[model samples]
Structures are given as structure tokens and as C-alpha cells.
Target: MSTDTNAIGLHTSTATQLAEHLNILLANYQTFYMNARGYHWNVKGNQFFELHVKFEETYTDLLTKVDEIAERILTLGHEPMHAYSDYARVATIKEDTHVSDGTTCVKGLLAGYKSLIELQREILSVASDADDEGTASLVGDYIREQEKTVWMLSAYLG
Candidate 1:
């Protein structure tokens, strides 16, 4: 195993850990994006237009973020896992099935947002330990976005 000092340079253990964490984050984001898309397509009842539009915006933001996080992993000298199968395996956020209502969808998405926040916190700790200030900053940005999404989704439930 490479020492922390050596890893601090180019090909470090930190990079590898970050790469794995990034893959997990990518998968979570992809799942969230698809779930949001599903909600956008199937939302019904009173607040349909509002919920649909909001879900679309959330998914679109996630779509961009997924790409950015993957690219960042590649920039760190690691290959970003791109296969859907791989994402399904790595993601902590489970796939949604049989979502029947807007409220249910919102609840699921709120859970996902919370999951993402937890994942980002772990990644942030890893980045901080590795002295990867850039990754830490990126994780912070993601945390803010996820928290805001969760708050908005939860508000709809109240």
C-alpha cells in the first residue's frame, strides 16, 4: 500500500478512494435523475403542473451534475463508471417502481435527497482527509443542492 505521503502526490490511495466514492455518487445522482423524470411524467391531481415542472428542473440539474462529477473523477486519473448496470449496483438510492401519486413520488425523492446528502458528507470527509480541496468544494456544492431539493420536496408534504 502506498503511504499517505506518496498517495498525496499523483497516483495516491486518496485518488482511488475518491474514484470509488465518485462512482457511487454518480450512480446515486443518476437514480435520482431518473426518479425525478418518472415523477415528472406520471404526477397527477391538483398541483400537477407545478410538481411536473419542478421535477423536470430537478432532473435537469441532476443530469448536469452527474456529468460534472463523472468528469471530475476522470480528471483525477480514474475512469468514471458509466454503465447503467454498474450504477445500479453502486448506488445507495434504490430504483423506484409503482409510484402511484405525487405525494408518494415526493416522499421518495425526499428520501433520495437525504441519502445524497449523507453520501456527499462521506465524500467530503474523504476529500478533506486527502487534502483534495477541489473535490471538497464540489461536494459542498452538491450538499447544498441536495438539501435545498429535500426542503422543497418536504414542503410539498406539509
Candidate 2:
């Protein structure tokens, strides 16, 4: 590997790739957060109180992760993609619409979490290769938390 480094001491080429992946992760998190917000607002059923609070918590965590991911991109000396337009262009997770059912909302959350895990795993691999421990640890933490979330959500659905 070339010793050439960016402002942060990472290889410039690897940082660029990591930034691109992180941007995709950011976009997905934005869409997921919005979906969670919608679920929190629109959920109706016997489980209303429980699900409403859970959705709020989920979105709150996602919003924090979105900011952290953006900051990591900046720390890599690359601009994070911020606009919704750019997110729409780059994100794999599509916007969920008019989904007011608790079951449906949980399903959407599952899908979103699955997508995030896959992308984060990719980021983890690249960060490992590039020796970017900060980014690697960040995504690793996200992956672990989300995996537990997926399990809990799955249990809720069942």
C-alpha cells in the first residue's frame, strides 16, 4: 500500500471510496429516520403507545447516526452529501409512504436495518483495508447496535 495520505493521514484513494460509501449510508439513514417519524406520527392500533415510543426512539438514534456519519466523512477530508436530492440519487433505501400500520412499519424498519447492515459491512471491510480504525470502529458500533435492534424488532413482529 502507498504511504501517500490525505490531510487525516489516510490514503487519499481509500478515503474517497470510504466517503462514497458513508454518503450512501447517510442517505439511507435519512430516509429511514423519516420513515420512523412517519410511523411515530401515524401508527394506530392496540400497540399504539408502545410502537409510537419505539419509533420515536428509533428515529432519534438514526438521526444521531446520520450526523456522526457525516462528521466522519468530513474528518476524512471529504464533503458529506447533504441534500435530499443527492440522497435520493445515491441511496438504495427508498422512501416509505402512507404506511400507518404497526406491522407494516416494523416491516419497513426491518428492511431499512437490513440495508444498513449490508452497507455498513462493506464500509467495515474497506475501512479495515485502509487501516481507518476510526471509521471501522464507528461502523462496527452501528452494526452491533442495529443487529440487536433487528432481533428485538423481529421479536416484536412475532
The runs of at least 3 residues in candidate 2 whose Cα sits more than 4 Å from the true structure, single-residue gaps closed, are 1-3
lDDT string, candidate 2, 1-158, tens digits: 45678888898989999999999999999988998999999999988998999999999999999999999999998999989999898889999989888899999999999999999999999999999999999999999999999999899888
TM-scores across all candidates?
0.91, 0.96
Against the true structure, whose lDDT is highest?
A: 2
Winning model by TM-score: 2
Model 1 per-residue lDDT tens digits across residues 54-149:
888889988999989998898787888888999898888988976748889889889988998999999999999878887899999989877877
| Residue pairs in clash, model 1 | 7-12
Q: Lowest summed-lDDT stretch of 10 residues in model 2?
A: 1-10
**What are the lDDT scores of the predictions, listed in order?**
0.85, 0.93
| Runs with alpha carbons beyond 4 Å of true place in candidate 1 | 1-11
Poorest stretch of ten by lDDT in candidate 1 = 1-10
